[model samples]
Target: MRGIRNMVLEILETAFIQRALVTGIAVAVICSAVGFFLVLRRHSLFGDALSHMAFGGIAVGLFTNIYPLWTAIVVSVLAALGMTKLRQSTKVPPDATVAVLLSSGLALGIVLVSISGGFSVDLFSFLFGSILLVSPDEVYIIIGLSAGIMAILLLLYRKFMYIAFDEEQAKVSGLQVSKLNYLFIVLASITVIASIRLVGILLISSLIVIPNITAMLFGKGFRKTAIISGAIAVSSVIAGILISYAANIATGGTIVLVLVMIFLAALVAKKAERTKRLAGIKAEA
Candidate 1:
């Protein structure tokens, strides 16, 4: 315990560590909040698809000598919007669209990288993440975007809830279901892009997904599930960062593993609760 505390204090004294912590917490919060709706709407793979699209975007930016993050945001948002439109207009299943996009994005990224003369260190960072390399400017952008997303969520909570529960009903009730669906895809795209720097392209979806799954094990309502998921995500990031720093492992991988452990723990608790309830019912009978 003493060693852990000392290590944490030592790590905290570094600016890089501070920036990583702030950016990670911000990313975790937004992802958790948005993930609630994503999971409920059965669009969890949407995040995975968009993340790969961000990879292609980054390659485009790199090939053109532009800032990759902005390029990724643009590409991802457009692709997300396109995916939504395709799902609405075509006879294709949403999952099929996502799968097609996922593979296409990865293939595009690889081809672009080849054209750009193969993988560079910068490209590798986006693939696996380098939290220790998070810049102050990126930190600010992450915080700003996260705050904006939270505000939008708060403003449209009821509408979003209705849409998540029943899109057909929401549309019948005069809610702009189509517009809201587009809005959510845009939000998810932004969240995925913002997370890429911290958790990387491959694992960013895990940040958006695992915490929400863990919270759902408790069988809570949507709002409570979101709140709990956000808390769990933030805590896991903090814990994972510290542990990774102390043990010298990959931060993103560590954070994802921590989330998985939390999910397993939740599963055990939920099962125990069910057993207890069933026993109580039997005793009462």
Candidate 2:
């Protein structure tokens, strides 16, 4: 135990580890907040779609010798808005719209990489996540964007909740459902961009999804569920980072694996509780 504590202390002292921890915690919070609504609204795949769009944006940035982060944000936000517009204006189903864009965005990214001759190590970092590569400036940008997203979410909490549960009702009640959806999509796109550095494009949706679903098994109300999801996300990130550092594994994958494990545990616990209750009832009968 003492040895483990010493190792943890030593790991914490590393500059890269410190930056990763800070960034991971921030990303976890925003992902939890955004993901809760996404799950409730049955839009969990939206994050996955936006991550692909952001990949295309990153490719564009790299081709133009621009900062990939800014280009990713621009491309993702535009793509999100376009998806929303297309869904609203056309007869395309929402899932179909997502599928079309998901394919197109990924194809665009791959073609760009091929045209550029080859994938660079930097691109791989973004694809698979390299938390240790995060610079201090990027940390500040992530934290700032996360804080802004949280503020907006808090301000419109009830509206978002109302819409998530019943969009048609929200619309009938004069809630401007379309405008709020656009805002939420934009926020989700930004959240995807912000989290790419920590969990990468491929694994980011997992971070945004698994924790919230796990929390749902507890049968809590929205507020408590969000809190529990945030707690799970933050814990998974911190534990994943430390374990990856100690075990010399890929950080993003490690984090996702940890989340999946937690989710499975929750499932088992819920099942066990249900079984016990049923057994008690049968015995009483």
Candidate 3:
């Protein structure tokens, strides 16, 4: 415990740690807000697909000697749009489309890496992430993406919530559910691309989905869910960073591990509370 405390203080004494903490918190909050709708809609796999696709984009950028992030963002957005288009045009389920996109994108990334002679570092970065290397420019980009995500989520809060709770009713209410759905995908695309810098492509979806799952254990209403989820996500990020610093592990993986622990803890606590409530009722009766 003393060593952990000392390490925490040492990390705080460094500028890089401060920046990482801020960046992780920012991305965590962004992911959690989007995640609330994501989990309920069963789009977790879809989000995972986009994260893997972003790997292909990064690989292409590295092979072509261009900024990998541009490719990452463009590929993610276009793929998401394609998913949206296919969903509208065919009876094929969304999961099937995601499967196709995911396999092809992952294959492309592998092929690109193998042909480039050696891209293990790049591949690993996409897979596990390298949050410590986050630069000032990337930090700005993350902040910008965070702002854009928040604005879109806030502006369309009602429509998204409607679709989240009752898609059929939302469709009948003339909510332009299809359009809103596409818009949501676009936002998620941006989010995935941005967060990959902090969380990596492979583990990024966990960052998105876990906090929302944690909140579903305790949150009573939609708004409360978002709030609680965001809080959990932020706490997980903070804990992840501190653990990473103390353990000399990858920040993304550490953060993800922390999130899982949090989810477990929340579930156990909620179950205990419910059990106690039930016992109290029995006693009163």
Candidate 4:
């Protein structure tokens, strides 16, 4: 225990470790907040699809020698926007549109990278997350993104909740349902882009899926659920970063694993509660 404390302190003293901690927490908080609403709205798969599209952005960055994060950010936002526009043009489900983007974008990314003589293993960092690779600039980007997203979420919480619970009614009640829907996609894209620098394209789905799922399973109230989801996501990031530090493993994989563990634990606790509730009812009878 003492040795672990000393090691943690040593990591804390390092600038790199500090930046990683900040980036991880910020990304987790923002993504989970948006993710909760997404899960409620049944748009979880859309997040996954957009994340994969970010890979195409990475390929563009490699080909042009532009900053990968910028490339990813612009392309992902556009993809999100495109999905919104595309939805208006057809009767297709959002899932179908997302699948189209994923398959096509991933293929394009692969082809682009191949045409460019293949990107360095550095691309893997974006795919799997590289908390340690977060420079000071990247950290600042995360902070700005986090604050911006949180502000938007705070302003539209009630509207988003109504839309989630009853979109048709929200539209009938004169809510800007289309505008809000577009905002959700855009914000989701931002969350994914912001996260790619920390969690990777592949595992980022954990940040979206795990917290929202766990929150839905256990939490109450829309606002409260979003807050709890953020809390759970942040906890996963901290735990994963520390574990990766100790185990000398990839930070992204470690974080995803930590989330999975938490999910499993939640599952167990929920089952136990159900059993106890059933017993109490039996005794009452």
Q: Which candidate tops TM-score? A: 2
Per-residue C-alpha lDDT of model 2 across residues 127-241, encoded as one tens digit per residue: 9999878999998999999999999999999999999999889999999999999999999999999999889999999999999999999999878999999999999999999
Cα distance off (Å), candidate 1, residue 194: 0.3
Decide which is better by lDDT, 1 or 2.
2
Separately for all candidates shown, the number of backbone clashes (residues 3 or more apart, or on different chains) is: 0, 0, 0, 3
1-285: candidate 4 lDDT, tens digit per residue: 999889889988888888999988999998898887888888888778888889998899888889887888888888888888898678988788889888867987999988988767888778888889788888888999989998999898889989998999999999999999888888988899999877899987778889989877785876677778888999999988988987899899888888888889989999999999999999999
Q: What is the lDDT of residue 41 in candidate 3?
A: 84
Residues 242-272, candidate 1: write the lDDT tens digits: 8888889999899999999999988888899
- The runs of at least 3 residues in candidate 1 whose Cα sits more than 4 Å from the true structure, single-residue gaps closed, are 283-285
Q: Say what the RMSD of model 4 is.
A: 1.2
Tell me the alpha-carbon RMSD of every candidate. Answer: 1.3, 0.7, 1.8, 1.2
**Stretches of model 3 off by over 4 angstroms after superposition:** 1-7
Stretches > 4 Å off in candidate 4: none
User: Candidate 2 — which residues are off by over 4 angstroms?
Assistant: none
TM-score of 4: 0.96
Candidate 3 local lDDT, residue 198: 77
Candidate-wise lDDT, in order: 0.91, 0.94, 0.86, 0.87
Which candidate has the top score in lDDT?
2
Candidate 1 global TM-score? 0.96
lDDT at position 9, candidate 2: 99
